[model samples]
Target: MIATYSGDTMGTSWSLQAVAARLSVVRGVQAALDRIVAQMSQWERESDLSRFNRAAPGAWHAIPNEFADVVDAALMIRRASDGAFDPCLGALTERWGFGARGSVDRVPQHADNGGDNRQIDFDPQNRRIRRSVDAFLDLSGIAKGYGVDLAAEWLLANGVRHFLLEVGGELRAEGIRPDGQPWWVDTEVPPSSSLAPWRMALHDSSAATSGNYRRGFTVDGRRYSHSFDPRTGQPIVNGVSSVTVLHRSCMIADGWATALTVLGPQAAISLADAQKLAVCVIVGDREYISRPWRDMLG
Candidate 1:
């Protein structure tokens, strides 16, 4: 029998399913997830990430291994996406009222643009980070995906081979179910459409979807997406509704999804082609799938 456990976390929810039916294992998994939230949550003032955000400029702050790993992934993606996906948009996120400070009625005159990846330095040897500039770091786009990966690793370490783990909308699946069926997941259809949901069978891989439909606000009849473009210090005005990425690591998939969403359909497709990444981008009424992603679907 497949055992399941789920609870609220990271301002959202997390779910885990494993082949072994053990309450002890489930409890261990929950504890592990809780630790991740305590370390990485932007909503939590005492989180490791929060402390790093508030750290003095040019001062190196020692971070937990997991936190460092997530940062490393974010930095790599920031370069790969050509700065399209940035973790340094914390100040911008707050200025736009998307941060822990809450939303505002209108956009601010001067959005604080401090958190560019170039301003931050990581010393992997010591698992510490320092910022050259006074910038706030926000890992919302990629932290949850890393959380999912952590949970998956915990399960594997506990000898649970067949499992599906999800933190927020980011997820990873492996092996087969108890009944020998492949693990399946459904993609969210655009809210404006009445079409059936898209489904995919996952096996030893991770998938993450990033979209502006569910997380945004309208101001004076103008809608602003939570996905911000670091260069403009403003929410993206792209036509793409959502972008999903499939990769060996959920962290990479999650970061890529956010980066590709900011890039829109045309540019995203080009980057996907160049990087040979498996991607599916939803632009208005149409869906664009990369050749690598289409093969994954088949």
Candidate 2:
């Protein structure tokens, strides 16, 4: 028989559906997720990421293996996405009221890539890093997806091969259902929209969506997106509403989702096409699908 477990972590909810679930399943998975949170959560004052954030400039600080791995992935995506998927925006994160402080009183300025890009250097061999300037390294964009992957690893290593794992709406699946069907999930939809539902099958794959509507505050009738452009030091105002990415790794999916959302429609789609990424970008009342996405569906 299949069993299900659910709980909260990293400011979001997580759930797992596995075969022959034991009492240890929840504990095991929770432990795995806690590992990531303790290493990467900027919310935790003593997390490895938090410590690194406060590290004196030019002084390299050692990071845990997992934390280093995620930073490596983030930096790769940052380069691939032309710095659209940055991790050194913790300062902007707080400025826009989405950081460890929870909220702030500041009006967001217009978009311009002229702001400081915050220079952070990673030493992969030593599993350490240093920064040239003081900036918060926020993994909020991608850590949740890594959390989901951690949960999946727990389930797979514990001999539960067939399962579906979800954290904060990002998801990963492996093997097959007891009935041998793929785990099906729907992409996020805006509130009060009558758009037709889009579903995807997760069979050893993952999906992550980034949307402007997910978080932000409205001021004087103007709405802001939680997804900020690290290059601009402000929440992106591009007309793109949301972007969903499918990949084998949940972390990559999460990072690409944010990057594509920041790139807006035309440019995002162009980059997705160049990267051969399976992406769906929603802008205004229209949907833009990449070639890879169509291939994935078929």
Candidate 3:
């Protein structure tokens, strides 16, 4: 049987019927996820993408298609949202004391609409991106969701027909669990008012939530979100607390959730309607709202 824990850091469970093979598969999947994380992590100064961050302007280097693909997805979301979400907002994030080493209680001016991410440009076709200023690429917004998708792929390839894979808070499920129920999750925030969680039966889909509660800092006696607005180059200060997105692909759901959260309730609702993206938003007061498509849940 798979060793299960009530409060494991991963917050997940797996049945032990196919115990031996499942462990092997999970290990392989974990290894693969680690590799992808290393390659994409902005924190690792030695990572390939990190090297690009340090390169001089106009320099082009041959990058792996895998890396290209991940950044390409990020860039697509950046463009698709008209700059509502940005991966190139690393410069401001650090200056605001959200980076490797940050000075607590000091709110930098660039934390608002005066950051350096405006100079970064991504070119999808050439697999080359440029930054006129020094900056970092923070994948905190979408990495876990991408990892979930990767894990699901690994499980499916192993002939596992029924499973739920979650890394961080991004999750994907297929078929039914050992109890013969579609694997599900709750979309409620923890009692702390500091953590918003999600619940859903992910039989053939992926779900992800983005929130401002866990990753915020007090600045000038007010709280500011880590989510940056690409269009204005500032952190989102809206009242909407969290957003959960569901879609066929975990990556899309993950990216869109963050984007929609930054957009807040009204704008997110409008975008959900326009793009037909299935979404749910929980305002600061605990009232949950969702796209009309979520009416299918009834």
Candidate 4:
């Protein structure tokens, strides 16, 4: 018997279901996701990588496997984006008032002390993390997509051949929907009365959107977005409203969305082409394009 549970998890609506001969497996998967969240949330704070606001210097100590996994993903995106997308933006993120705490009236511009590329010491053998710089990290870039992927894996492992998993709007689809159609989701846009939402379909793929339009603030006549440029320690003022990436894994899609959001359309497109990655970026006024979006959907 398959069972389903729908509730708020990680500050967003989520549902999990599974197809096992016995009903208990679905419940188990839900419990598993919940447990992972509980553990990751704590690791996000105590880990040295999250050094925003109050993260003490010299606290770059080894953490557990969960923290290691997030660091691993962040490092991947950092290298992929040539340091455009980084985990070390925690201090910069909070400096611009985008962390667990809110804004400050003023912040110092980032000092280019060659501190950006400070290597994080992660002993995979020991599953620990160490950092040489006084940096802060935020897994917000990759965590949701990683969580969604984990849930999808859990369901598929339990014989759920058809399902959709979403966390904080990052999504993944596997097999088929119950109705026997490819799982489709709209490319979400700001709700303007004059504009209609863009839609896309998915089949055994993942998609994620990162945007300043959805989450941001203004202070002293300056606008700030949640997407922090780890390189500059400043909010990106790019005209792009949103960038969505489609990829094989929800984790990669989520990370690339943030990376390309920072990169904006032109540069992002260049990098995506160079890497042969599938991506779509939506700028303000609904102008958008993805070179391989049509082909990827097919």
The deviation in Å at residue 227 for candidate 4 is 1.0
Ranking by lDDT: 2, 1, 4, 3
Using all chains and alpha carbons, the TM-scores for the candidates as numbered come to 0.94, 0.95, 0.85, 0.83
> In candidate 1, how many Å is residue 295 off?
1.9
Candidate 2 stretches greater than 4 Å from native = 108-117
| Candidate 1 deviation (Cα RMSD) | 1.8
lDDT of 1 by residue, 158-208 (tens): 888999888878889988898888889997667875556678888899999
Stretches of candidate 4 above 4 Å error? 1-4, 16-29, 42-62, 103-118, 192-196
TM-score of 3: 0.85
Candidate 2 clash pair list? none
Candidate 1 clashing pairs?
A: 88-115
Please give the RMSD to the true structure for each candidate, in Å.
Answer: 1.8, 1.8, 3.7, 3.5
Clashes of each: 1, 0, 6, 2
Write one digit per residue (lDDT tens) for candidate 2, span 135-223: 56988888888888877887888898988888888989998888888988898866645576598888999999887787888887887
Candidate 2's displacement at residue 196, Å, is 1.3
Those runs of model 3 whose alpha carbons end farther than 4 Å from true positions after fitting are 1-21, 110-126, 190-199, 286-288
Task: Assess each prediction's global lDDT (C-alpha) against the native.
Answer: 0.83, 0.84, 0.67, 0.69
Prediction 4 TM-score vs. true = 0.83
The most accurate candidate by lDDT is 2
